[model samples]
Target: MENKKERYQVALVSEDQKINEDINFFLEDRFHIDVFSNGVVLYNHLTKEPDKYDFILSVSGLTGVHGLPLKETIHKLGFSHIPFFLVVDKADNDMIQICIQNGITDIFIKPLDKITLQTRLDFQLKHPVVGWKKRKQEDKGFNSYKMPFVKRVFDLLVAGTVLLILSPLFLIVALLIKLESKGPVVYYSYRVGTGYNIFKFYKFRSMFTGADAKLHQLKHLNQYSTEKQEPSDLEPERQEVKELCEFCEQAGGGCLRPLYDDNQIVCEKIFNARKKSDKESAFIKIKDDPRVTKVGKFIRNTSIDELPQLWNVIKGDMSLVGNRPLPLYEAEKITTDKYSLRFLGPAGITGLWQVEKRGRGEMSEEERLSLDNDYVKNFSVWFDLKILLRTIPALFQSENV
Candidate 1:
């Protein structure tokens, strides 16, 4: 069967009809364009189908509900992963900075010539909203350094290489895990990785065989770290999620809800354990987790368990260097502002602060923000190399590496 051509829908909202039409006329050859007189109308469509378009273009200087308002609204919607462009005059530096701070797609300046708009548009299409999409396209493969590439390539390469060279140590650990526990050899976790997609992360099984099932039972103890306690809505959508074993155990699919769809063959949801946080958006770690097995502690502490992610790098599930991939629970924080731009690129094995302050855990989300932002702004292949070298000695001092 022939595959359907991918659809690329775009929105352009501007006060000037001439400019709007010009953009439309120019873009028609390339995309499915939707023109709006202002941000209001465009926002309406977006709200209806948050993922409706491939891109959104909001021009500056709308008298009421300016560009910033529309962008913030999208941010609130938490669909900040969608690619969006800002149209403005070059003199609008303040607005540009605000857009940058919020992680808006690059800008399109006023009096935008066909060449520039097309160029910027090309870049957006080139860098899709997620990793799976990027790898699917013909963009250049991974670079160990730079902006276009994720920031932690250096860390990944360094760590992955070391692990491969020290495979015998991992073998010893594997044997110890077997000697110490009666369980599966590896712990396969369905974690939310780069692109917010779930992947089975491999680690020498550090926890007990059924640790996950006991998490709820341990909730009271785990809840002690209120600072780490996720917001109310962060848990699995239990009403919606079909528990694997329970579902299989039930005679009639465990009695579904009113909104159940007969057509959704499985109708099972794996609501990620890591729900994106709803706060200022700076949590990427699962702290002092009770689900961690005794063997898990040694691997996690020595940072030996992350070796499996090297497969992610080879398979392009992640980059060697970039922002560390946060679980969905960590998403809201990055998208919210603490490190908004940090989410713009791929998740990494090690990144800016990972080599520097990740070990001490001394840096606040803000400090991490500064380092990540600097990486994005000044990213390059060589820069990745420098970070890679800086990471060598620092790995001993850090837990993230």
Candidate 2:
């Protein structure tokens, strides 16, 4: 018999009683479990007894606190040493990438296999997640992309010269941005680049202040937003189209996929399948976006807003010619096996996609990913030079992408 003191202590947080009960049933034999109904309560308890658990397992969506935000809070509160695992109903590629980017120690999909859960927990017990470490794609069998020495030297030389000569233009742009908007001159956001590496990406402030906070509200304006199909009045058709996942809805199991919930309790997998069938593009792009200021519009049209990225190139976050680095949300959506090859090459300011399809006004997400993958598979210094030369003429083409 195992001694009570020898068992690992676990904290499980979930609002679903059935889920809590099911997880407890699977884990009770091997670990000591303390359950919390929400993240706030667990956080409060941890404050008083920080060392009470060796690991934390929480549902993605909570009543008082969401999983990703709670993890951010935990890190901010200096609890970065504790292993934190996220529990989701379905483990979609996008969700997995998002969780890993946010430093989740591990993720467990719903209808959790007992043996797999036990094995994972046992391993985590022996080697607890210590400091919050960024997870990379090395273990997934992709070699980390390294910039060639010639490319690196070229980037440094070009970026250095551009910053030197364009220093005056940058100041002028900064003044115009500050005069036009009430925010800082430069905007910076986290971007995922080669090998799934996250870095701070910079650009001159083109959109209005607080543009990011309003992104969700303005998703309807996205050029890539799919038109939803109105349900047919035919009963048989509606019945046939009713989305129900095998393990989630059809099996009468509790809701496992929460990301796609349409306020109707539909599983994420089912909802995503519906969206996929509808041909929704995961990439969001808006033409003539309402968020851009007049100054923003002018700078963006001339590609002057992109100049600050020279600093990023100088810092080795990117190269002069490669696939453009993507925003976090965009990166998450494309992390599936079909599109992940894009990340195995250098991320950059301009590349094959930009030169080939920037002003075409009809580049689909699949085409863009395909172009990026092609670049990754056959990039060389000579090819980079050709791309750089092509970019010079297209630099001032105004598409308002």
Candidate 3:
């Protein structure tokens, strides 16, 4: 007798009863489906147990929410590896491109092909997407760079000495943090490090208790986003002119924008309109972030906020000098082949990127990732010492202010 296949948990969101029924008819046998009427309800359910669902299925345009922003939020919360499939009413090139850019796994147009959909879903289940946990276990021998004995010795010595000497300072900072904020003195979060290893990264708390919850709301203030698109003289004129589609000519105006989908023209004004989220920068770095307390600002500027990471270094989660470990959200964005090289090196408290452009706030995402790769290529005891020396000067300077 053939063994029964495991039923994967799926979260399907749609208000259209017929669509949900149609999808259930095809997938229920192989998957356990939990239906949600809207994205907001699904999102709340997801936050409680982000790893519960094997995958997610949602309509292209949710009842009250747009699909792309929801995907972005899910990725930002460190659940990017979950396969999120979008079902659109019709095939739309612009919607497809946007979905691809945001890392949606697949798209299915209306009147889904049962054979094609089932085959793709089965294939995905058999070969599931790798998350950080699996990557850490499987890639260790092949991808992780073994720390040299001398390097490990140096990290321990330096980290130990600094932490011991700064004990009094740590106490003072902790007191200040407590006095200024209602949160814990130290902020710890899951950060992706060398070889895609996830670890609890610690820092002196520099913001309020719920600062992280406010991150998405404050995305508009990101300094990096401001630089994503340079101002052009013709931008004003471009926004005013609603380009007409020759394929859908009318008296007043044709389609605002025409997008080709499988050789068919789709006049989608709804999808084409400029959205505030589209302006959000891939990298999040806000100048004078409002969430920061007065004590937070002082610690951040003086580099005191990062001092707590010495504990991480001593605990073997990082090194004194290597590529800085990235938060889960930032790390997820750079997992493409071109940028994955950064993970082969050690996670660090201070590194080449910090030394090169610590407070300039001008380094683009590409430049930062390239510098990380560069450090991975040239890292040595001597190279690390040079970077350590450079870090002292960089810490004292803050052109970003």
Query: For this target, which candidate reaches the highest TM-score against the unseen true structure?
Result: 2
Q: Can you give the TM-score per candidate against the true fold?
A: 0.45, 0.64, 0.63
Instruction: Give the whole-model CA lDDT for all candidates, comma-separated.
Output: 0.57, 0.74, 0.73
- Which candidate, 2 or 3, would have the higher lDDT against the true structure? 2
Summarize candidate 3's per-residue lDDT along 306-359 as a digit string, tens digits: 998998988999999989887655664454456778888999988999988877
lDDT of 2: 0.74
Clash pairs detected, candidate 3: none
Best by lDDT: 2
Residue-level lDDT of model 2, residues 22-74, one tens digit each, is 88888887678888764545555665676678888887632114476667655
| Model 2, position 289: C-alpha lDDT score | 82
Could you give the candidate ranking by TM-score, starting with the highest?
2, 3, 1
- Against the true structure, what is every candidate's RMSD? 17.6, 10.5, 9.0
**TM accuracy, model 2:** 0.64
Question: For candidate 2, which ten residues in a row score worst on lDDT?
Answer: 131-140
Q: How many clashes show up in model 2?
A: 1
